[model samples]
Target: MTPRSIDEITARADEFADMFEGYDPKPGDLDAPVPPVMAVKLAAWRRDVAERELADAVRAAREQRLSWREVGNAIGTSGEAARQRYGATA
Candidate 1:
């Protein structure tokens, strides 16, 4: 599927927000878990956020002259793996 461009999303943002804000769910629905597709999307969004945050941290750590082994240990990986993953970023 093609991703929506930023402008397309921006244009629809207010409409989406209005629809979301207008919801009037039944009392029982208040305690319900998210739908399966929403759950999957939420998980993907979390992972993307985590990846960006990790890259930012790794960039900072490299700027502080931290060793790849140290960074790897902090992130639960081997030094070589860390180097290969983020070497160019730093």
Candidate 2:
């Protein structure tokens, strides 16, 4: 894998953050009318993007020789949990 520059990493992070902007469904809005089917599709698409980004990050961390424990710590889970979730996919 080619090493990413700090700029590249920052850009990707920004893009990931942008993915969640204005698209999250609010629980308090349950009384509001149901959203269009397109909203569901968009939410699924966002989930897909997030999953791919997570796999890529896991792969990158592994390449950088970071231990599963470290990766898990960063992600707020146990090493085994992190490995089980992303190891094969990464």
Candidate 3:
């Protein structure tokens, strides 16, 4: 998937968050069909949450003076690639 801008991610993520936040369940909802659009939005929100979590983990590792190579190894990527993707100037 192409990378989304932070603004877009934040906006869309919040929309999904609100959707589930005030959700009121109805009887037979489990057996009812869900709108495909909502399903897609849920999937996107999940991805956004996981990515933010990964970013936080990476930031912690960097703060501890961990090498990009080590981070890459742990995350199944190359050292330089990891650094570039995470916006690590060093």
Top candidate (lDDT):
1
User: What lDDT does the true structure give each of the candidates?
Assistant: 0.94, 0.89, 0.89
Q: What's the true lDDT of residue 11 in model 1?
A: 78
TM-score of 3: 0.60
Between prediction 1 and prediction 2, which has the larger lDDT? 1
Compose the digit string of candidate 2's lDDT tens values, residues 1-90.
Answer: 999999999999999889868467778776775578968988899999998998899999999988999999988999999999999966
How many clashing residue pairs are found in candidate 2? 0
RMSD of 1: 7.8
| 1 against 3, candidate with superior lDDT | 1
Among residues 3 or more apart in sequence or in different chains, the pairs in candidate 2 whose N, CA or C atoms overlap within 3 Å are none
**Which ten-residue region of model 3 has the weakest summed lDDT?**
81-90
Residues 21-57 of candidate 1 have per-residue lDDT tens digits of 9988988887888999999999999999999999999
Worst 10 residues of 2 by lDDT: 26-35
Distance from true position, residue 10, model 2, in Å? 44
Tens digits of per-residue lDDT, candidate 3, 1-90, equal 999999999999999999999999899988887699998999999999998888889998998999999989988999888899885533
Ranking by lDDT: 1, 3, 2
